[model samples]
Target: MVNIALGASLSTVILTVPVMEAISLYTGQPFIMAMTSVQTVMVTITLIVAAINLNDGQTNAIEGMTHFVLFATFVMLTVLGL
Candidate 1:
C-alpha cells in the first residue's frame, strides 16, 4: 500500500507538470516550475521520512498520523512562502 501510494504521488507530479506547462502556454501565462529552497528541502525530508517509515513493510495509525503532520507542515510552509 505504501509503495502504491508513493508511486501514485510521484506519478501525479510527473504527469501534472507537462499538462500545467501546456496550459500555461495556451493561456499565455508563465508556469512557475521552480521550487524554493525550503520547498525542495521539505520534499527531500518528506521522501526520506516516508522511505524510513516504509522500510519495515508495516505501518500503523502512528505512521499515518506522522504523514498527515508532515503534509500539514508542507501546506503551512507553502502558505507562509517560507
Candidate 2:
C-alpha cells in the first residue's frame, strides 16, 4: 500500500513542476503552477480527512464517501474554473 501510494503520487503529480518548467523554458512561455487555491484547499482538507479516517487503522464507506464527495466538489469547481 505504501509502495502503491508513493508510485502513484510520484508518477502523476510529483513531476509537474519540473516538467512544466522545462516546457516553459523550451517554449519561452510562462506556465502557472497548475494548482489553484481551491486545489490547495482540497488537498489540505483531504489530508485532514484522511488522517481522521485512518486514525484507527481502518476505513469505511463513510470515510470513502467523504473523500469522494470532496474530490467531486473539487473537480466541479475546477471544471468551472472557479
Q: Tens-digit lDDT track for model 2 on 1-82?
A: 9899989888767687688888999999988767988899888999999898999999889888999999999989889997
TM-score of 2: 0.64
Q: Give the per-residue lDDT digits (tens) of candidate 1, residues 28-54.
A: 999985899998988898889889899
- Backbone clashes in model 2, listed as residue pairs: none
Q: Candidate 2: worst 10 consecutive residues by lDDT? A: 9-18
Q: Could you tell me the lDDT of residue 18 within candidate 2?
A: 81
How far is 23's C-alpha from truth in model 2 (Å)?
14
Q: What is the C-alpha RMSD of each candidate to the true structure, in Å?
A: 4.7, 4.1
- Candidate 2 segments exceeding 4 Å error: 1-6, 10-32
